[model samples]
Target chain A: MTLTVRLPGPAATVSGRGQRWAEARAGSLLALPAAVYFLVFWVVPFAGAVWLSFTDYELAGVPAWTGLDNYRRLLGDPGFWNSARVTALYTVASVVPSIVLALAIAVPLSRPGRVNGVLRALVMIPAAMPLVATSMVWSAIFADEGLANTLIGLVGIGPRPWLTDERLALWALVIMTTWKHLGLFVIILTAGLQGLPSGVFEAAAIDGAGPVRIFARITLPLLRRTLLFVLVIAVIGAMQSFVPAFLLTKGGPAGATEVLPLYLWATGFGFERMGYASAIAMVLLVAMLALSLVQFGVLRGGDDG
Target chain B: MTLLTRRRLLAAAALTTASGLLAACGGSEPEAAVPADGVPRGKLSVWLHQTKAYDAVFTKLLHSYVQEFGGVDVTPLYVPVDKLDAKLLTAFAGDAPPDLFKIGGWTIAGHARKGRLAPIIPKAMGVPDEKALVAQYDQNAISSLSYQGRLYGVPIDYTICCLYYRRDRFAEAGLDPDKPPATWEEVAEYSKRLTSADGRKVGLQWILGNPQWTLMQLLALVKGKGGGILSADAGTATLASDAGVEALRYYGSVGNAKLSNPLSGFGLFATGQAAMVVSGLFAMDLFPALNKQLVFGESFDIAPLPHWDGGQPVAPAYTWGWAVAEQSKLPYTAWHFIDYLQREDVAARQLKDASLLTPVKGWEKLPGADPKAMEIMAAAAPHADFGPRTPVWQEMAKALTDAGDAVAFGKKPPERAAADFDQAMRIAL
Candidate 1:
């Protein structure tokens, strides 16, 4: 018995191959500007940094090759390791809470309502403002007599040196960072929640499932991919954060908030150690890449199900 | 036939020469040179870190420069002081630095070692030699602007850190405001009486998170106790010496590091939260400017920076100088303009308008100068110590700042902090 299989779409036109070729060519032309932008802005600098990592360029003279010296020195540098630890702590402290809080807010605001729309817009305002301006505002808020202490005072907590004390400076930065970034994540997760199939929720409701049960049984499982995306981006952003720490703490109160980017900057510009800074950049890139891969592997499981 | 051909050739050559001369005259940028009229002709680019008060006085001076030299044009760029170093470094790296700039005395060695600054030409400044140029200003001020025995800049803004105290706070604490703490030990004792119960009001709130000020403050303390940041040969870090440990311990003994003010100690003093601050002559005007209620010599007073109780006197002074870039095409003209800017008359105006001491010889006698402030500065000048001269000045500074903060905030013991600073400095030294 001979079986002839038919596909489930329109038949090929006489000029379909030619049409496809033209379409691809047009698409490539349209994407050319973005491709060039990626090459010029991203690829060139990355490659230059990789090359500079093996040199001894002090930002004043021609780069002289000194293979692996920068990386070797970085290995022994206590400051680098301290900054690495700070970056990791800052990332975990800021990212986990921000995503969780965003989800908590996003679930209720995901519903179709005028009030939700207004709330969503208001939530987006912090993320919309310039990071520098927001950082300055937060600096005031963390002052001794600022709003932060005033709020904590309501709970009978004595005034704390939020930005000045070594024990509290990093936590203060984490709090500011969470507040600064929570809005964008909420909007993103709200979009994700709204995109879930209503049929699944309807079935859960028919089965006598309450809002919490429906959320646990239907919403979360469906929103895994979106959560993964948000988590990866947020982690990357936290890993690269520099401004708040620089402006607020200067990586001080005894190196409490000295994140890697700030350390890299201080090395490159302050000490004129461009080569070592580039090595740091390279290491940071590799770590970020490894992190993203691991996150994808863990969070993206059971896709076929 | 030969005569006619020769005549035509001469005519053509004359026409070509005329056109070339016209093109030279019509060019956008005139070639930097002195014409037969002896007026140096060029466009100058000047970079200065902005102080609102200083900018007004400096701007008028620059305008006068352009007017005085009809053939020259001037472009002045004002950068915020905190960002000036980074901006200047970037400009230098790009081979596009301004013709002239104001640079910290501490950075002179580093920049000069990198071959970025031009050595000052005494002839351009109407002086006979380096000796004559050095004679024009206080020795310590001009010497701080030199590298390896070569003068690189002319000092323009100078300050020796001095104790500033509020008389009202002093009286409230039942201490004589006229006799500000004469030693570090006295400062600690006075701080206890001055500090409020809530730990908000304290005496001598050390400027935190500022590497430059930290170095200056620590320099005075360490050197007063007979220790130095670097050894005599400048080959090793000596910040962990006995005197250094004592200095840092003394530093940590006073002041509440937890005090949160945007302007650090200066803001606290202006608002009557702190009883004393170690600042420059500018603070005399700055306190009143920050708070109109703070009247100099009445509500507040100045005193010589205190020395160690049983140790030698050491006053830490820092200066900013007018320097010409090595890449400048009009070095002579740049120096001439700098000379004009550094005139005794202009220095007097700088003090009057900007409260920026110029450190000119006999500056204490400048007309309209605040007698008390000048007297203190003049006395401090004899013992003034500019921090260690090193090509790795920035690294050394950062290490000192880290150590200072560690001690002041009780993060680490003074001994450990000093040792850590020494270790950090080892990498750069």
Candidate 2:
């Protein structure tokens, strides 16, 4: 009101500086709760797990320190090798097809329309369903007299034990896991596609680019970031898969479906070798870390380009 | 000093606030609510593998106890049978174990040795007449449950392996409906005769999925032939004994000779694709549903488990039971429930409802039991054998199963498999 021109005086400068510092301090304080939470729940638990890995810890008693005994045993154990093979097969089987199937569905579903909306919702229903519930339903369907076999019988195919047969049980698990996880992949890919710029596509069309050419050249390159994110998540998810195999197969028909997690569970819980279980867990953690590092490297390499 | 700086600061603060909100929103479901009464509140969970009948009975029993007790609540959790040991070990290690749980006879010793089980005698529920009770239970089951002179859990029920055959199918094959096979050779002949080339059916099924059951039955046969699974002290594995090798070889021969439906095991039995199967009493209820004309009998000819040449009949019986948790704060209440469950009246009612045999004394006399059950009880009462009392029983059982599977699948000769089994047993011990 007085039309005073405030000059950049020392007092004004000092007050400004003080206010900025106060605001930054407030912001840091606001972030403190979350930082504390992460440290307490995640960082601390991880540290404990790492420490436990080196000990002969059975849950009931005090843990004893054993240097690399568990790891040495793991190296020589046939069970560990068998489990590693199963985990790798489980990951490859589920991840590759899941990505391909998700891409196939997502590209078409990205287009906006009433039909697309309904189809997308239907596809997402499996992802929305609880995993344990899905495993249970799949278990029944793969049973000897389950609906799948009943369907097979219509084609004059004799009943096969999808969940119980040694040869087929792991495959059945892979199928069920793929179905459950595919929807999430489709949703992620579809989001990436939707967020894509339309100008580039229009230009591509004007330059006489066909739909396939546009997708291959324009869409895929732009979607690299999202694809990398999905790939990393899918691999991690595959490695940690437990519920489907645990529920449906229980690592049976002669341990045909025994994945790493199940093997760890058996060692820790079944045999009461907590120390050994910890060692297995540590190995799994290390493997996951290595895989994540590879994914990080690829992501960084893509970013550089 | 400047509006732009203030606005930027506000925006940064808001973004941080939003992220905090998201983090809170994305957290997992909260832990189960602690009871307000604070009666030493902790999770009182129980793990079981049995579905339907067993689940219903145990769950109902726990629910009633919880209702009566009021201070602590009991939660019943179901695990698959094969995963029970693993799951229990994990849960116990997590320090969030079920207050009370069940394990197979073969698993008790291992759990006991690890001291995972709280001693039932001193801290938890104490059974009256522990020796007599143990004797009444399957000797093998009791032996497996015992560790270093300490009895861990009470044996709940005995699971006796028997032969389930289609009575109607036997009649069609021109075999006597009243008489089952009396010996291994007779079983083979009957199985072959019953087999049809129709695309849908097989002759007889053995449980290949559960190799332990097959091994135990084989051991029973060996003992019947005057051979044993181990020395009297269970200090060494006698699986490579002449009787043991012969017994396993016979089982392998049956598979090779196509006298038994090796591939069509439980699957075939469930779908009525097999005429005969070696199964347990627990599955008897489903047989009638699978085929209305199903008949139950002992392993051979409604007698006890088939004898070897001149030896007495020895049936292998597997048993499971309830035990109070060592960590249970409501030990008195848990014991009260256990004592209530063991009463003759309560035991009979539960057995009738669950279609399970009772471990309580004189409860077997409950009226209206199938005559076949009475026959089994009579035959099994005297000569039933159990595995060793050492904590190595689970490993030993696994070794046995592996040996049995090798023999059954023709992957290894019975003698070699038996020797391998003996090596495993020594390692376990």
Candidate 3:
């Protein structure tokens, strides 16, 4: 009884800290599986690839560490340089045609109708078709005596070696790739057009704006975000392109069509130079990241008005 | 349908499913098919290319092996030619690879170096030694399977690179149909004589644009003139040597003479648009089907690749063989199956059914064999040899082919082409 003293009041609960702790625990619980997956599948492999880039790995023995040598070799490799150039050129060539043709097709068929529906469906046919079958059909079409040449003969144009000629094979890839991928971009832009409020277009038309004026002043400005999205995706897809070059030209006719992916594949799997290939892969990854950043930055800054 | 009963059932089901998944993840390893016993009894997987064309052959041979020996189940998995190598690399990295596979013998050396293959020891095969093994098969076929002085596969098919000529086309060009060129000079003359005046038809069509195809085809010219595309051990490029330049000039003469074009695919050869084509033995099998009027010996025939002036003929060849994977659990069973396939009757039957030339000795005399084709194959067997056996062969092929195209189509001089090739190969090596 004598020792009884006034008990200190229960320590004040820091309400903000309590709330934050509970919220963090809940968030961690929700994100654990995804975090684990990313760590295991992507981050781990990426780390391994980075490590491998510094070593000589041929898949048969212990990887010997030869730091920076693979990267050094890549700098001096003419084949690597040629492939990088091809990859860059192909990315530009394919992305531009795909976006332009997609927009051209999308604008005309933007309005909803039965005929438009059928035409859109027909346009989507090539995109739906597998690249393997498409390659065979295109190969047949490009033959010296193939359907493409046969069709062009009516116009007094001679047979063009679509795939067999070194000067033309890369261009042929660009054309076929445009045809295959145009439909997706068309659908995306069409969806974007349909999402726009039609009242703006109507107001512009009522204000004596021509169709061209309406497009330039209203449509293009509104679709800038969608266009940028499509451009970045198209760029990435074109840079990573493989099958058309692999199946059609086999990176041949004196390495005329040897894009970066094909070259890295040959170096890694074909030549058993996994370390060198990993170095190539790191370079490709960095280049792709830089491209995406610069493009998004420039496109975003270009508008903002 | 009551909620309480359904909840209980659902809980039971979830528990059961989770247990089943765990069990599957930690299941016992499969028992080895080949044991220390009378006969092997289990699934024996055989991987090969062109399964549609070859399933019957593998089915028959493997079935007979099982019937004679003991109990074993065999399956043939067909992979496309383009995907086979990559598929093999993936399979080798995986824990379970095919027990047996058929692949180009020339590629065996590369696979061997990767430790993906097991050496085909003659003693283990029940043959006395490699000499006895060589006695039963064509040496040329066996040579391609050898890696570092040890053979790693059993050669089954000899894909001989020969000169396939059309008699009708040659006669159309005012050349004697009965005579074929035996020398490279004669080849040039024949090309001149066989080409049509209007240029609608050509004298020859070698696969030109593809570096791999062009280089392999041009090996005949290089090898015939006492030259080679690689070092003896296949570690360096010899394609820049004087002999190689001479070979490129010989290859370029086709375009220079206007006997062929650069972009012609095998279609030109198949449609008889070209009189003579440098192709493989397999081309003959497609002639009658491709060109209706064609008769085997009457319309088309194969001749050993023509040699350079006063030089020995060279039938540059590629072979496909049966190899045992290093991951094979039933190695004995796999080897035994290959052993059975190489038996005289089975090897003979393959040529007849599969339209592939067998490497087994006396395969030419097998039933369902054509007399004249057999004669040509027999004559060519002694001279047939493969390209460089190094894993770098793909690059070597590309360099030589680039040289070939520059000289042939780009009109670059042989010396210039060789210099470029030498420079490229310096990087490749």
Best by TM-score: 1
DockQ of each: 0.48, 0.13, 0.23
Better of 1 and 2 by lDDT: 1
Best-fitting candidate, scored by DockQ: 1
What local lDDT score does residue B335 receive in model 2, on the 0 to 100 scale?
46
lDDT of 2 by residue, B72-165 (tens): 5667789877677667766666655666777676666666766666555422234455675565544555555667787777666666666666
Per-residue lDDT tens digits for candidate 3, residues A115-194, read 99998888889989999999888887777678988998999987776676667889989988999999889988888888
lDDT of 3 at B47: 79
- Please give the distance, in angstroms, between residue B94's alpha carbon in candidate 3 and its true position after superposition: 1.7
TM-score to true structure, per model: 0.90, 0.75, 0.85
lDDT string, candidate 1, B1-429, tens digits: 466688899999999999999997665553343344545568899999988899999889989988988877889999998999999999998888999999999999999988999998777787878899899898889998999899999997899899999999999999987788999889888999998888889988888778888988999889988899899777899999999999999889889887777788889899998899888887877899899999988999999998888878888889999999988888878888999999988999999998998888888798766888888888878898888889889988888988898888898999999998888777667
For model 1 chain B, give the 10-residue run with minimal summed lDDT: B29-38
RMSD of 1: 6.9
Can you give the lDDT of residue A158 in candidate 2? Answer: 78
lDDT of 1 by residue, A1-305 (tens): 99999765434553767778989999999999999999999999989999999999888778999999999888777678889999999999999999999999999999999999999999999999898999999998998889999999999998888998888999999999899999999999999888887877888899899988877777887888888899999999999999999899889877889999999999999999899999999999999999999989887852212
Per-model RMSD to reference: 6.9, 9.3, 7.5
lDDT, candidate 2, at A177? 88
lDDT of 1 at A195: 80
